[model samples]
Target: MKALRVLLLLSLVAGSGAAAEPAADTGREPFVFQSDRIDFDRERNLVAATGDVELAREGRILRADRIVLDRNTGIARADGNVTLIEPDGEVLFADSVELTDDLRDGFVEQFKARLGTGSRLAASSGQLQGGTRAELNQAVYSACEPCADDPSKAPVWQVKARRVTHDRVEQQVTYRDAVLEMWGVPVLYSPYLSHPDPDVTRKSGFLTPTVGHRSDLGVRIETPWFWNIGPDQDATFIPIVASQRGFIGAGEYRQLFDRGRLELSGSLATLDKKPKERARSGPRGHLRLKGESHAGDDWRLRGEFYRASDDGYLDLVGLDSSETLPSFAEAEGFFDRAYARVGVFDVQELRSGVSGDTSPLAGPELLYEWQDAPSPDGAGRRPAAGAALHRRREDENQRVTLEGGWRLERFTDGGHRLEVGAGLRGDFAHGDGAADDNNTRLLPQASAGWSYLLAGGMEDLQMTIEPRAQVVLGRNSADADEFPMEDNRAVEFEFDNLFALNRFPGLDGAETGQRIDYGVQTSLHGAGDWHVDAGIGQSQRRKANRDAPEDSGLDTAVSDIVGRVGLTAGEMTALGYRFRLDKDDLTARQTALDLSVNLDPLYFDARYARAVGVPDPQKPPGPAQDKEEREQVDVGLGSKLDANWSVLSRYRRDLDTGRSLLGGLGLKYEDECLLFEAAFEREYKVAGGDPDNRVSVRLVFRDLGSLPGTQGVLPGGRR
Candidate 1:
């Protein structure tokens, strides 16, 4: 019956506030001196009540066998199984308790308090001064609000501190003789510990370490120190140390500005590589710098820097060969509006140790535009529209270009279309040697063109025809003087849509030339998502001086035709073919063929090309006007696959050398926290360049902290 009564009494006082009122002295009955079952007395003006006494005021509740309230002073004391409850559902129990208003300052010989947020705090005996401070000795805190008697079974761990003082303003807790325990077992102890509060707004701390292995570098490790400086800025210092090719040291710095942010990284290694002669390479280093900024009115600046020792350093160290390093400086600036842009570009090479310095690539270009339409959203419909003036120089001679042109591109719901305007551009140059500025005749140049598109036979099947014409009025055109004139002819045909209908990589200039080009194209679909597209075109030109290569049947001809057909099967299958003809001789001048296949877990791409020069052409016996020639071919294949892991490979063939030009392969594997990759490739050339191989690895971790009770290493206590 006593236990039941005790349990009932606790239920009534749980989560209740402490209540104790002072007695009045204005002829009052000492608040209370006697009751039917209790007695009260005033000794030395100290109001004392005894026997099943219970006091309740405001929302606070106080219960005990005896209570003392000193009316003359501002203090209250409760003895024998005393319990004090606050309005916020925090209950405090102790053998004896004393408190002032606001609970700002309190004392309990033995105390335990349970807060509402699944947390509990306790100490043998202590004092709390409002939210700003708390001085505790031998305290234990935990996220778990354990059941009354099974604290060991709580789901969370607790941090124990011998002496701790917390500062609410700074949201930090400093402690001595601290121990972090889980299920009653102390996993860690600290003579002194300081950590961000549970509600700390600014988290500052140390970071975790990174480790990895590379066949070339052996082992690498790094630990970074992070500083939370303040709200607007922060920084970290990371020291990277690695073994394999001697000791390598590295560091990185980053900063954020009001208008932009910048990041810079650099590394150095002594005796880093195996040398061909008596000693290994001296000290080597790599640096990368980047930044981006924006101003008002569409004005922006951005750039990056990448440099290193001879390219071989990357290959030997298993780094990316594709990482092109420019020991030179290349800078560009842009100022623009929606319809116009002005820009300047400069390149200065720093490789020479000569007595003088010069910039080889320096130029300023200006272009203006007037438009009355919104820009197209697709790349195929993004046509150029402007007139540009540029100056060029080679060795000592210089020339200028004055060209004006217009192009219109639009994509309707059903198809795409383009209309291009031609321009008359004249190049005037002078040099010590007439051999430098090819054209001496000051040619009269003019050009114009139009193209159309029409769809038919289902949405997937479309046909397009682009017809173009250009007329030039003059040319000395002498084979002995290959120059004294520019040779702008046809282009080497490739998959690039840039000037697609115009074949031959522009080898000879078209002057005093009249040519009509006809292009007919079509696309079809079916089979493993197969896609087919084909096109054929023809052109013709005339020269003022017949001494031109046309006499060799390789220059100006009555007609030349080119055609290509290609098909794509699903994500991995492809096949293509190309052919060119010399109309005057009715013969073949070029031919090409290719095939490829790709699948998710697998991939492949291949290509082949050939150019046939006119060694001899018998203009079709009588008047038929058609010729035939030999072919020079170039071919390559690249592929990737996945089984136990992923792999990549590439192969190339150069018929001109009757040898393979290049080939390569690579493999990789990765998971949530760790990643690794390695590759070996070779690019063969009759002269210059070799196979470049590379390897790389990376790892990520979480909840990394200085100690169990400290702030996490990450920007946040995420893990």
Candidate 2:
């Protein structure tokens, strides 16, 4: 039963406008009261409400079985299932409560609160002071979700504190004499602990700690502290302690500005003593520094510097496994159709019998590139130009190289293509007790090719078959043996590079004789989300370069046959294979295969690669190229057993030696408010090296602050 009722009582009170209005009245606001049954005692200046009583003002609501309000004293007493909801959507429930005039200061017994972070707080007794502070005695807090199947079951994790204080204005919570409980068992305790409210974006605090064991470092632990300098800047400091090694410290700092951001991180340590000779030798500790920055919208900078106190320092400390660290700094910029970059690079040797003087260094490297838009004349021709300067140490001599080139390509309507390119490069050699001299060479190249697409296959299938041929000519017939090989050493023969003027990746080494490159390719596109592509190619050198790598597939008149095949089935599976076979015997010289599949709860991937060994033809052979074949296989799997549990595993093995290289297994569990994971792994360092074992564990509690309450219809209360 409901009725429309309105009461407007206007009375001039002492030093105020209207008596029936709120205390801080703006004269425009009104004070309304409603209940199932309302009765006023004029003699006592008191109002009593029963039967689902409710009082709402300024977005704040108070509901209880019964409530009594004294107009003169401005105090409200609520009994029987009392609930108070704040304007910010927070809710509190208590058996009984007494609130002051402004509803700011109050006391509650057998109370519980639900915060916005999904965490809950329950206390035997609580006090609200000044509307911005709350004090709870003998309280329990938990972020874990209770079992919906059984309301009587306890949460997975919780924290009990003798006393807790929450400061709404500062957005922080502090606990004293706190105990951390897992699965209803107390596992950790602290005298004092504090954290910013979940609503806080950044605050100073201690992050989770990590503990692990390594063969060289033994048992080790790392604790990190985070500091928020400002809204755009922050830093973290981590201190590491190990039983076998001394203390080490690592830190990282980052800042954001209007134009760009900067980040710098590093780690340093001091050794206890020299390790035994039988152990991995080299540095006693490691040093690593890295930084990156961006300026404006078109410019960027990056740098990396890493070094080890000894050969085993990095691997033992679990920082990195490489024995050689290359340090470099580069800056790059982009324009409308042009790009420019400059950098300096050097290498650090941490291995035994390696000297710094023997390692090469590039003091300064510069490059620029530009491209012209397609010709408006409809020839579909594009012109591109590039230039570079490199100063580095090569073969105990100081070498300097300056080079530039331009290429023009024209495409015809009949699928015909023509390319013309020319370049002039010079090299100046000096220092290292070598005769100062300059070697200049001019390179001119041209190629032509034609292709046709033959469509209309079986059942809406389309097929394309294309055969292409190209010929490249150079001015110098010296095979580039006179110029020091600074950058281009390893060359891979593939269909993509079949018609290339130079198979080498860089300008250091150039192909110097006439050559004919040709290939045939076919592709099939089916209607049922299936496709197949395959190609076979080879190169023939009219004049051979005896100085080239023997198995590089480019030194003989008839190079090895390079072929590739790829197949895909929409989004479910894919497979690809590439191989280089000997021209005479058709024996595989280099081969690789990759396969992947994704089907709901099951996923898998596998890769295998084998590179045959062949002795270096140019250098006096110490270790034959095929002395130890490079063959390995890698595979991984992931399966979701149910809604909250998943299993994952990965493995890598040396197929030739039948030895396990690396393997790991992991299990993970996650629910609404909690996540847990554990993993075990084994890693084999290098040839003849023993295996290293490792284990890791992690846990996360989501929605760290929340509370429970009954259903309500207030403007901002739970729906």
Candidate 3:
């Protein structure tokens, strides 16, 4: 009943801008009076201006055909062509107006107002509760046309309301039955709405929701609610609605301290319940921590932690789209040219994993890194102090790493350059246990480099070629036996990024022992925006101590060959190839070739790989294992021909078995108002000729004038 009464009163007030007011004081003589006459009424203690009359008090001016002032009420009533001018450069006109001496707050009928700043407003009935605001019966707000000398006639966008209550203290207006209008044409309407007048502090309201679908998760719906919690913190709750059945929710919390900021998010419920039954679910969560702060003039502190509840949990629920999440913490800063850091890492428990299984491992890793930037002087550069400490539960032995490196670079005239570098390293690790334990030692370290470059060409032709060489001398005590190994994850965050012409994620692992790597690389660019480059190298490892010990698995060798080549035409076509050759057998141990092309809106990529004597990853491992030579070929096709549609397709085949291993497709639709997408993929097997995994995806979004269910969506139109 109260709400209804409020609504009823608002409706009346919106449509009616007229209100009665008492007459003003008549003791002071009016500065100006016009028309037929000025009448003084002693009995009523009122002064009246009749005919085409005008009255002035201080800087306020009033124009009306007739005016009456009451000494007791200090109110002024004007009829016919009533206008009020306040001290603050505001001119107000109305058919009938009742005002106080100050005119800061009052009532008016058929009100039309133009303020000091040229912003205009109008209402049929209203009450000016304060100097800069009013409770209007109906009002319009806009600044499309400047209210110049004649501000009343300016063009404007309006907000029509049945009733509007404007609060100067909060600088906002609340309304019922509001419609958005432009040039007097209604475009949108809403039952209730609120907006800040111009500038204000924190305000709470609804936010837009996102819609999408995943093959495994089915249809997806997420609506987020925002909370403006105090001044230093805020939060948002996003609820996910699944078509299949179940609610998965997520939220983010943020807070700021004097030294740092913190943010975290985790899912509370999920739709999939395969590996973990719903009974045991929702207890799992993830954590992340990162911060940076100044400690001294030249030293700083930084750290990052990323980890998930379980390894497969994120993959199953799609919480981790990147497939791999590492939980690690490190703190390191620099002083002058040198730097160092130490990090501790732990693995995220994998779902459906056996209690104690090894293999399929990267081993264990602990890293201590150091680096130094070069100075402008011609003095020799400094070397880095680095180390790695690692051990695996699967293998008996732990590992230790110590290394240092230095390099020099100089640019020559005519776009030429040169560089030289060297390094030393040592590694100690054991495998197996006690008597059966195998100890592997490497007193191996050496490096050298002499490289050159040239870049000068015709208007359309440019080229460069460089040759490099390095030497390493080291010894190895290799009685390391391979035990069932499990934990091995090496994580890196560095400024000295490695640049190579191969797709191998860990190419640096093979960079040890005594060896001299020599290679010449050449690059050419001519007409048609085409480019080509290739590199060939051979490594000569140290074996000077061969006569001192019996034969072990570790054999110091001579030159082993490695090379890579690549080419790209116009901006549309590309090709790449790389190979590793064993010096003892003169056979290529591993080879890969890839090709890609873009036909305007269409693009495609094909790749082939062969490991001459290796077994397939899907096959069993044991003595006398049936090792099907590892060979594979894959292709991907994607295109966006028109503005509204796009598609992507991928396929992979095992050449040796003549089998299709994988295939997938993705499609999308986009336009001015709506967006839609769909995707499907399958993981196939050879003998069964059936896919082991299948996936599908979809998403859609619409633009509404304002966020849904928000008070800002006046006129109820899409924003």
Candidate 4:
């Protein structure tokens, strides 16, 4: 309504170059007025402007054919072609309006307005009440552009109500007997509807609802209510009713403090009877909590807690799509070039054949690390160090381990690059159910590397070829097999770790004896913003490490050849490939490829990974047999058919088993006044059941609330 004052003032003073002096005794700012003819009614104490008159006050203006003002009564009337201009450049139109001198109390006929948010409002008649509220007899509103050809035609969508009230004091709009119309046809009706105006960002109300169908949960419907408790805190509660699972309640609470933020979300449901009549399956649910804050100058604190009533609860009720639930809490601190962290974690093993009793809970793990960045002077050296203490609790056994390590390295370049590095690590272990209850091992290692780069290519196509070699010396620990391997389970042989000081990933496993790691890498920077890089490396060990799985490519005297290739052309395309080949037969042991192409309307992304299982060392060695194998592929496609329509598809498949893991297809349409989406998806082996088929649809009207019915698609949490 403030716009009304500005618009009216603009129309009243458009041609008045300067404001007229105020009355001698009024003690008020002067009013600017312009007109073809102005008459002063001395006897009646009235001023009248006729024929293309304009009036302005402050920064507002109003133009009308005739304007009449009664100085004594403090009433103003504007008739014929009335237009008001606001300071923010908003213009309002009305057939005629009457208001007091304060520009608060007013009445408008045939009023049409365009708000700053691109929304449109029209009223048959309106009454200004209490200087802060406006009531309209009959009104219609939309956030759509009217058709230039036929303004009378209905917009894509609109809301029509018998009585509409705008309460400026509350920043809210309320409607009575409201009807939601699409193409002029009423599709939904409600006795009352209210929402925060465009200016209000948060308000308490009923949010959109979700409707879906599942094999286990049957027909699912969830309606969520939002409570805006305060400027920094809010909560949403959703009550779900399913034909198969009965009623379930879920909610999320979030709050932002001066220095941190916290959030919690979860769901609970009660079943009439458990499927397969499992013991203790009456009620199921899951909860997750997360919080982060600054502790001090260089330290930060964070914590997380997640738990599930049962392994199948999430999958059965569609809360979490994963079969595993991991819960943990941690705290961390940071310093210049150094950091420390402590954490405790527990995993709920819901999968069959897995016993939670045997799974150890990480009671408390303390770790510290410090590393210096590469020398900025190009001639300096630095040392890095780390330490850790881990305690785990199994069924009847408790284990404690302490470990520490340090690495020092120096690098220099003079025609050929040279690097010298040394590392030392020690481990102390004391535990109950192990071959060696108490044990200690010390490892010392040293390595030297040299690399030469040959750069010579055409002016437009520059290329570089580099060959590097490193020889590492270490003594094998005879008691390595007597210790328990708790943290580390698998080793990855990739180009990124090809030249690492140690081939094993964790402290529990370390390589020993003499070894030579050599590789040559080449790079090409050609025309058209294109670049290509490739590298291959292999390791030759003086002694075989039978402790490593055969498929790990590190169990033999000669390690498998590992290589990687990367290609990119600006933002439009990217491709990467990494693989390990058998040292003797050159057979692929593990391979992965990732690629993405963004070519305008045509976009594609894909990833494929395959690995041959390693041979089990516990079994006798005769003919090497694969102990495990995995192959999977993921692909996505997106296309914009036109300005208002788009299509998307995604697929995940297990190539080894020739099975489709997950697939989805979606279509979207959007225009000036309407947005529509429809999606269908299938999730296989999720929640430990058959493939779950789901279909969801959504329609949102610009100004009015959206037609709330869709599956609760958790943002960023894909099954």
Q: How close is candidate 4 to the true structure, as a TM-score?
A: 0.85
Model 3 Cα lDDT, one tens digit per residue, 554-597:
12355346678899998789999987666678676567899999
- For every model shown, the clashing-pair count is 35, 15, 27, 19
CA error at residue 380 for candidate 2, angstroms:
12
lDDT string, candidate 2, 54-163, tens digits: 76655667888887877666677889988888888888889988886456788988888888867788899999997778899998888777778986577888889999
- Those runs of model 3 whose alpha carbons end farther than 4 Å from true positions after fitting are 1-218, 228-234, 243-245, 255-260, 270-311, 321-324, 349-400, 404-444, 451-459, 476-514, 540-561, 568-600, 603-641, 644-719
Candidate 1 has what TM-score? 0.49
TM-scores of all predicted structures: 0.49, 0.82, 0.57, 0.85
Ranking by TM-score: 4, 2, 3, 1
Tell me the lDDT of model 4 at 369: 67
Evaluated at residue 613, the lDDT of candidate 1 is 43
Best by TM-score: 4
* RMSD list, candidates in order: 13.6, 7.3, 12.0, 5.7
Off by over 4 Å in 4: 1-44, 48-67, 79-92, 147-153, 274-280, 371-415, 453-460, 614-626, 686-689, 702-719
lDDT of 1 by residue, 472-497 (tens): 23333323343323223222432222
Alpha-carbon deviation at 257 in model 2, angstroms: 2.6
